[model samples]
Target: MSVVNPGDTVPSAKVVVSDHVSFEQFVVSRSRALLRTAYLLTQDRHLAEDLVQTSLAKWWAARRRVTGDPEPYVRRIMVNEFASGWRRRWRGERPTAEPPDTHGPAIEPHTDLWAALANLPRRQRAVIVLRFFDDLTEADTAKTLGVSVGTVKSQTARALATLRIDPLLKAD
Candidate 1:
């Protein structure tokens, strides 16, 4: 019961469609969670959306190799991609006396927490987002970031300490 014709160039069409269905189901169920994590990593809605889209495309291409839950694998891809983008941007960034107005003024979040989060370095931000925002264990955060659990612990500690010292977040 093959869908291929004798002269057809395309083979395994049915298998491809079935695999696509599984991937679609996985995306439907988990996209919001992924998007939230990406937002935490990027702190911008458009970048977060693009990050999730790219991560899903990469995951779909490598779906065959992914066994069991895809959440962790997809998360790892998102973190890596964001970090790569960060590095590229870091290299290209030209410091100016005044910030560029390409996006105009940013609409800051109501709470000071987001502002504090933005102050941390990229890796620390990633660790905090994975450990607290995404609710992953320290070991899992380390795995996602390709670092050791102790590194995750230290980064999380440093991020928390920075946030704690923020004047805006100080008790009234």
Candidate 2:
């Protein structure tokens, strides 16, 4: 049996009763932040876009369950999906090799910052992004990661320590 689309329902049907806000409005408001965070996690613009679309689809499908400040919720979903994809790759015990030359000038690259972020374990990177980029409080970040506040504190210290050697930030 075919599942019915929203418009297929009879007139006066309540597909979304909350504010009657269309999906387009929500996407327009949140796409940039979602895409940026996805890029940071996936490290590829195209992949980041796919990640955001996947996340948004999931979020919209479960729209009634979420209310107020959905950004963190969606970000968490994107991160989880990214980690899941990484696990599916066949990169076991790979050798250290030179990175691609996407770091050349004219990009205004935050090479040090990004390299430092990449060095972090997945959980730590997620925490750092939620705490710093998302400007979420420690308690909120912990909630998003489903970890204790103590874990956030420990992970943040470790990530910042790794970044401290960047030299760009040392003089600042």
Candidate 3:
């Protein structure tokens, strides 16, 4: 049998540890921003949390292969996850006809904008979130969504047009 090379194996083991540390640091630094972006995409706090966790888990699994700024990679994962309509396997909570009462004052100031955003089609919504909320350029948004820049521009234009005319925003 051929002998194993210690030099070849040892460095790779160190690299794995280094990569793990980098990934951990990335998660610590970016989790909040990621959660905010996810919240905008999902429009529900619980769903946003779930989206961030799922995207991070998927990113962690492929961490070694990723290079440069991990934010874009993580963001791309979030966008893709949101677009594909990721849902929980077991939705234990059932919706009630009547809304539950809350004790605290309303925190979100831009409820009308959120409502308008919620009404947008998924692709247009993704474009709006990535371009406006995340502040990505047309080229960058296109790269993240794996679409052409023209598609990003067109979607952005269409979403904005729809939002401008939305009755929810008009009421405000």
Q: Clash totals for all models, in order?
A: 0, 0, 0
Expressed as tens digits, the lDDT of each residue in 1-172 for candidate 1 is: 3433224574322223143456667777999999999998888887788788788878878878887788888989999787655524645864342121222234444446776677677788888888888889988888898989999889889889988886656642
Off by over 4 Å in 1: 1-21, 86-110
lDDT of predicted model 2 = 0.69
Clashing pairs in 2: none
Q: How would you encode candidate 3's per-residue C-alpha lDDT over 16-45 as one tens digit per residue?
A: 314345655666688999999988888888
Model 3 residue runs over 4 Å out of place are: 1-21, 88-109
Each candidate's lDDT (Cα)?
A: 0.74, 0.69, 0.75
lDDT for model 1: 0.74
Worst 10 residues of 2 by lDDT: 98-107
- Sorted on lDDT, best first, the list reads 3, 1, 2
Error of 2 at 130 (Å): 1.1
TM-score of 3: 0.75
Worst 10 residues of 3 by lDDT: 95-104
| Cα TM-score per model | 0.74, 0.69, 0.75
RMSD values, in order shown: 8.6, 6.7, 10.1
